[model samples]
Target: MILALYNRQLVEKRSDEAIFNELKERSNYIENDIQSKLLEKNKISLTNIFELTGKDLGISFTIYDNTLQIFNSMDQYYKAGIFAERINPQVYYNLNYLSFREYTIKENIEEYVFNSFYKKISVDNKNYILAVNDAFNKVRLTFSTSDLDVLLFGIYLLAALIIILISTFLADKISSPIRRLTKATMSVAQGDLNVSLDNQEKGELKDLLDGFNLMTNELKRNQSELAELEREAAWKEMAKQVAHEIKNPLTPMKLSIQQLIAAFRDKNKRFDEIFEKVSPTILNQIESLNSIASEFSRFAKMPSYKIEEVDLANVATDVINLFTDEAVDIQLEINDQLPKISADNSQVRRLLINLIRNSIQAGASKIKLLINHENNFCNLVIEDNGKGIAPEITDKIFEQNFTTKTSGMGLGLKLAKRFLDGIGGDIQLIESSKPGATFKVTFPISQKNSFI
Candidate 1:
């Protein structure tokens, strides 16, 4: 539609110039013909000259000498004899008045138009109709062109506005999704795991959202597990120290009761032998009580390490040997290049023993101890081929009083971890379940001097 409008405007503007040029040529032709005929006939009067020129030249003619005016209409084609005879002389007179309004004479016969204006002039005693058409045609052309230019400009402006609006709408539509995704990403980065995208577009962006969701979920889960593990570790350390402190006073009481029972067992004290027999029984009970109290006291004491150079492999070997009497099968793999660690030898040995014993108690048939040096630290890993712990219970293994063993005070691994911690080391339940458990003990090089 716009193209058509522009074409129409162009044609309208150019048409005026075309018509004016055509009319100027036609007027020149007419003037030349009139002069040529007048010179040929040597006529002086306008009225007589018109009749002669009209007859000889085969074109309708017009001549005016003030009151005696003459005029004739010629078809656009000016086909000489054919159009001259059919020409309306009165219509030509009306054309002279219409011409004053800047009009063009066009006909289907010529498929063309011409624009000009008419005026009367005196040559000698006769008057002639002189067409002064240049400025007249120019003015008509100018007005026509101006109107066309206005229409074309209006269309261009409208098109520009439409294009601008369409571009703005599309830009917002495309950018909105990206903006939403950006905000969602920032929220996720800031630890909001529940952020979701509303876009259902099936493309790479949707895939990206899926990936982002997965990453956030994993991070949240890991963070939760880490917090829980820290709490368990803290509680385990506190409980272990408490138990260790509480076990100290019961040892001497158990011995005193046993000595009193033995004294009553003599023959001179037969009647007292009865009391002596009861005394030994009471002493046995006291000893048992004393042992229990001692275990608790030991469980509650916080480990204080004296750092020294110590061989982690020798400590691991001794821990394994400590459990050699058990029915469980054990294997030890210690790295020969294991660096001397700076830690309390006694605490490290206890850490290893606790882990090995825990694995054996978990119904593990074959226990594997791997000791190695890594990252300027000694790493002791005790793995058992028993049933692995349930995922739910594995995290709670380091908690005080949280135990899988019926025989333990539930402070073995707990205390071991505390002692390891006191020596700038850590004991971790690396893996576990009904299948088996693996405990890792890492002792730093700074504590190596105490171990030695």
Candidate 2:
């Protein structure tokens, strides 16, 4: 519709301008021809000058004498004598004042019916008013609401539809590769490092697909290498820790045995007493070795996640009850109607116990637990007035066997992170300006209750 309107407007303007220029040029030529003939010492009239064209001109004219008298006339096309009763006073008025060039177009009631252009021209001091009009009385068809315009409009609509289809085809062709690339990227993110795409189309985009395939290949290779290196390093660390810890008790046990042997050789009457004193030392050292093994075994071989709807508030309450008799002050703040999360029941309990125990052992006098919802996850914020973790080790605090104090296996927060990972949750140590440690544990809300 818009195109049709624009085309119509353009054609209308062109037609009007063509007609105006044609009329102006033809009238100027006729006037100059007459003036030139008069300048040539020829007794030429307007009719003889117009006939000199030797062909039928598309202009009709009448020349007026000094008193506005019709000196001669010729109608090569039409509108020949219509101006006999109508001549401009301006031409005579201007001619009287010796200003000879006066011109104007007199319009008919209809736009394209007729237009007569009259002018005052003087040649060799001979003055006259020259009235000229178009030879072709052609009426331009209306631009709006015509049968031809309707046909053109139909063609315009057809062209528009064709363009739409072509562009749509091109868009789909362009976006198909991008869509595949996006999906492949998501696969890599989800740990499928072997993802790769075929370069179906040839363009600059082929380079993009090739680059993606190369990147994934490198990632898969690098990940395999990293895994092998990590396994070797982990085994080495574990072996060293086991050997050092076992050697601790083994040394004391060997010392106690030496003391027993001395007593036996001396025939000491207190040999039985010496044996009794050293026996507990040997048993205690054995027990320490067993404890060390058990902790490492648990850390290395965590159980598979048993996902279930677990009320976190209830789990936290139960874990809090276990440490209620301790010196540390425990404060629990929970919503009255707390949402349940999808996680292993036992893991939730253990996670809470581990964090609370950490706060107590950190010399915290007061511990705060705030349970709330964040988007599609449950946020369990644990704040403690303990000595905040040293900034240097904060980044490594989540690693297996990483710790700051002299204690048992450093697996509390590591276990928490593992459990959260299994349950599509997360744990982070919040950085605070205050003098206490803050940990935020996130558990995904149960799928049935969560919107996303």
Candidate 3:
């Protein structure tokens, strides 16, 4: 619309012939100026009228007759006859006669013809058509689709960033509780039945949170009931052990007294011999009962651990040396640098003695005591080539009053474990079903001054 309005204004201001003559005169002046400048510079080169025109008004002017004369930032000339052959047949036919036409063609021609429209011009009684073409590149500033494309891309990128940020925030908001529940589930799996979750939301997540809380509550209740049942069972087992142990001594004591009463009633001469024999037997039974009572009392009133830096290797050596004359072959393997551990020296020695004696009682021929330091812990591994503990009874080996031996009060391993636990150490049966039972005791290495 702007171009048509501009053409109308130009047509109104000057007649077709006058506008044509003016353009021809301007072209002549441009050529003359270029020739003069070239002569002044002592060079033979055509002036780039296109560049000159673009720099000024950004318009290209062309005149066509038997040849085409084109002028723009890049000045070039072409023969109309040759250019016509390369152009579309219809466009060439339209432009072929435009230069010689006597009147204007109002309609704009096709794109191949430089967006040209025909107008009649007379100079010295000869007529020609003045062609005008729009050259946007001649202009310094212009809008293009590529600029719009860049703008749209920036807008889309901003939109995508906003969406991503919003999505991330929503995801965190939605999954935060689930993540907490997942962590709580992990704690539950690790035996933390006391865990509970908060229900702060008002949707499905809230329902999930409530469910999780209920589940944990149920687990806590079940764990409490189970612990109570276990305590009761343990007490019952202890009662049975106590009754059985007391019965062993009581039956013999009662029998001896009955025999003494019977001998007194018989009025027999051998009564004194019987009394002597029965008296010793009664005393031995009483001593056995006393020993059982002492064991129970010691277990009930276990001493608190007096934590001090004690050389573990020294304690192990002392225990091993005590059994030098025993039938078992005991070997102590001490590392070059054994760390002292924080424990009661007497308790450590007692633990070792009990373990060694148990191995000997198990008919072990070879006992290996390995002492070493690893990862800030003093490790004492005792291995015995004894009849390995049966798999069924291995779990009960550290339970108080649980024993396979007939002579013992059955608190050796249990007391050893309790004593170690008191000093922040632990004892474990590494492999009981192997050729030899292996026991591993670990104590945190002491950093204080050592009582080696």
lDDT (0 to 1) per candidate = 0.61, 0.73, 0.66
| Candidate 3 residue lDDT tens string, 261-355 | 99899997899999999998899998998999888776655655677889888777766665654567999998758767888777787778778
Q: Please tell me which predicted candidate would have the highest lDDT against the true structure.
A: 2
TM-score of each: 0.34, 0.42, 0.46
Question: Model 2 residue 194 lDDT?
Answer: 38
Roughly what TM-score does model 1 have, to 2 decimal places? 0.34
Tens-place lDDT per residue, model 2, 25-132, is 766887776666667737776456655632345445666776555543444222455434445565466556666564545455445455556566765577667665
Q: For model 3, give the 10-residue run with minimal summed lDDT.
A: 133-142
Q: What is the lDDT, from 0 to 100, of the residue 26 in candidate 1?
A: 50
List the candidate 1 regions with Cα displacement exceeding 4 Å: 1-13, 21-134, 137-144, 235-239, 248-452
Candidate 3, TM-score vs. the true structure? Answer: 0.46
